[model samples]
Target: MGGGNTAEQAREVLMDAAEHLFVTRGYRASTMEVIAREAGYSRTAIYRQFANRDELVAAMVQRTTQRHMVSILSRIPAGAGPVDLLVESLVIVASELVSDPLLNTIADQTADGTIASLIANDSGLTELVKSTVETVVADGTPFRPGLHPNDLAQFIIATALSFLMKTVPAVTDPAVARSYIETFILPAILQESPEPRRVF
Candidate 1:
């Protein structure tokens, strides 16, 4: 039992190390040997856990995505308003994508298909977003006319990601990013007369 636990802990460490390296350096620049060295593991040990760099990268992406979902769900307030919940969720997602090294690495990768597959396979995140959207719509805060809650949820998630990818590298100031979301993005998303804005 102790050996199994140790192996699991080592795998987690390797994944965390790989994620950091992959994000700081592009996929091509990150090698299994480099990951092993950074993780303080032997090349053979890394191979025993992960077949290759590609597998390690995939695992890291999946693990990070899972953690983000768990964090978001845990932070959501009980009995909160749907639209409010959705906005908070978006903020959380955006913050995580901006700060998480594993996600940064995956976003930088040119292989869109692989990234899409990773997201699609991760149902927990999608389901949480979908359920939150549905709750908001059902709670009388209907989405913009003609926009399905499901589609809107998807758009919100995708747009938040795209915005982060495009803006984070260019803007050094955190306030600018927050301002853009407040002054532009939020208004565009909320079609109602009284535009929704973050209260706090």
Candidate 2:
């Protein structure tokens, strides 16, 4: 319908303006009026799309993180081993934080940087991680007993996101990053290690 299309388009335009301003000016400095002016629209238009600047910024961050995740994960091969796939998934996340244009821009501009919290908090991403776990372990593999699939997924996603925010040199090398992640995060749910558990 003409109504929805025009509204959706206007929303996208406003979001684009907000994203640029946020990247160039940081979250605190970017204002609703400034975003509307940059979008060449009235403040009324933004309010139609979003209740406030916080809502608009949250939406933009969610969209941007989703886009980045989809792009990075799409590159992994389908036939790879489950552990390999999971490790690579996290490695790609780390690599993107340091390299992806939008993420790099956000890191440079914000004081409390990282869109990871936004992504990790979103139900969509949680669902995505669960779905990925289901899909990857579909080949007769089982997660360790006492660990819910969703809980395992949440642990992996949270650890991966936290690691992504760090600037460690090990994460700079995709191969090394993958190895560390495999040894660190995957062992918990995978329970592949024979070593005795130390701490909870």
Candidate 3:
């Protein structure tokens, strides 16, 4: 409220309250007034930070996912090959998303297409993944000759996010998920390989 840092701290506090309400009361039912009350802020104060409930939710999602992804990416070993990086990322990211409480609440609202729209419109999420892909590719691993890092990053994001909104039978089994990535996903982005490399 006093300056940029104060306002940012206030926003984080609001987002923390919103996450609790959204997870416990469900995203569809957690209105702005409810969130404001939970955060111990007036409705007017909430509006000063976010234009609407949708905006607040989007900001929360971005913050939560960026933090989660950085943790996941850091767990991947440095200089990992393209296959290992992509495969481990897809498996681990998708698995964690399935188990997250807030994401589960969002997924439950998929009948209204909220989850789909969130994923489709989130350029921040895509850019984060793309930046990670570009950085990892600098390690001299051979991806497909004509592949663009952004394109590959998009594919991984799309695939990883699919599990967020729905139960994927194939991916429920880690081995099957690995097989799908190795068989279909890896070949699309990686250079010709007679066999998939086992990284775990």
Candidate 4:
């Protein structure tokens, strides 16, 4: 194999090993020595690729978030009604946060202040969701008065994260969480009320 390919492979190996250790062992308890041993490399080799454990964890979080954005975008049904599409997008994000191993690890590690700061500084996910909403609004979808599409999109993302935090542990069934989002959030975003049907 080429030297560059070998180096790339080693980096992937280190990241995979670090992700597993960081998730299973907790970031504070998982030392570089342990990660090196897990990755089948010496401490020096690990340091060559990553300056420290924090950098390694940040890389893992970036990779995880990118994968998450792809997953959410893929699940958005084509030609869906605006409200339904928005709800599905929010649910996809919440589901990922609830189920994804890397995100779970980041949530765990966030207790130490590193992961929270990383997330607060990172707006990639927010921007992606905002762009999607802008597309819908540009396509002439209706939204409630006083709520700009971009602002509503940000609110949806924030609400999804909040719902994931509150309900993930207690609600094992996804339907329950979806119901809450649809019932509570959909009405707020709707632009029109249903017309009353006349009795025949």
Candidate 5:
């Protein structure tokens, strides 16, 4: 048990260094050696914790994403209706991704569409959003006919990533972003309830 705790602590220290290096020096430039040195550990120590740079980066990204999701979920009201919860979650995610320092650094540095690929694949961010979406709709929330929760989650993740990547015209304005989600996105997934719930 003590050894497990020590290992986990070492991994956290390495990840903290990786985050700083990846944000400041850019992802490709922050090699494992430099990350180890930055974390005050020998180069070989990093290998003990992580098989390769990719695994280390993945760990850092997963940690950061989990932290981000915690912040997102906390800001959302506990009593929010299903539509409101989903809309608010998507809006908050888009807002944060646009301004996220590490993600911005990575996106700015990548030339081979790495960020786009991450979105398309079931990466950490996608899985996090999918899990949230499933939770939101778990109470038998009605959707467009025949659309599964997983499909809706994927669509929402794609839309949020598109906003982050600015693949479409930039919805920089919050009002415009909320409107876009409410108008185009909500109607597609959410059934037209007679109650007309306000998603604001």
Candidate 6:
């Protein structure tokens, strides 16, 4: 089954080509013109799809995050507890950020601070990831009741990057990583340690 590539399809094709070029060369090297030529499209067509190089990079990030999240969510074991789910999600993200070809390429090729600034400036990414995770998990799956989903989602993103940057040895042992997250991170962030009621 084949048909002419629609605008959406063309945009995806451009992203794919950009990802390859970024991996082989680098983010700075994979210019819009290069991407356009790689995708077999004109610069005008690339402009129609993305206003600028930043927009193209953002689109690639969004697509990768969505695809990776869906893949990770689909594999969660049934009856996994809240802490387990969060831990699993973070673990998968960390692993993929370092190992996945697309994400790893971005990490390696992008100039220092480029990805960080992109993440910080993307205000909607937290909500997007949180909502996507909620929609995918079964109802009543028991995410941390007290922690805001936004913070949790953002923390996952931040922590994953930290792990990638640090090359955390804990990640080498899945069981160790899970234990540490459950024992420390989950309790610290998710536990509803309410302030004791002040008695006047």
Best by lDDT: 3
**For candidate 2, what is the TM-score?**
0.75
Task: Show where candidate 3 strays beyond 4 Å.
Answer: 1-5, 110-112, 193-200
Clashing pairs in 6: none
Task: Pick the winner on TM-score between candidates 1 and 2.
Answer: 2
lDDT by residue for model 5 (71-132), tens: 87788887877787767767776666677776565455444557445445646656666677
Ranking of models by TM-score: 3, 5, 6, 2, 4, 1
**What count of clashes does model 1 give?**
0
The Cα error of candidate 3 at residue 71, in Å, is 2.2
Give the better candidate number (2 or 4) by TM-score: 2
9-106, model 3: which lDDT tens digit per residue? 87998999989988888887788888888888888988999998777877887788888877877998987766787788777755566778876766
TM-score of structure candidate 3: 0.83
- Distance from true location, Cα of 110 in model 6, Å: 5.1
Candidate 6, run of 10 with poorest lDDT: 191-200
lDDT of each: 0.62, 0.67, 0.74, 0.65, 0.71, 0.68
Q: Cα miss at 118, model 5 (Å)?
A: 3.2
Tell me the tens digit of each residue's lDDT in model 6 across 74-100. Answer: 889988765566779877765555676
Error of 1 at 19 (Å): 1.5
The candidate with the higher TM-score, 1 or 4, is 4
**TM-scores for all candidates?**
0.56, 0.75, 0.83, 0.64, 0.79, 0.78
For candidate 4, what is the lDDT? Answer: 0.65
Which whole-number lDDT from 0 to 100 does residue 124 have in model 1?
53
- Cα lDDT tens digits, model 1, 1-200, are 11343777988888877777777776667788888888888789889888876666666755675677678768888876655565565666555556665565545554445454445444555565667566567534635566676676677656656644654443324445454455555665566634435322
lDDT of 6 at 40: 88
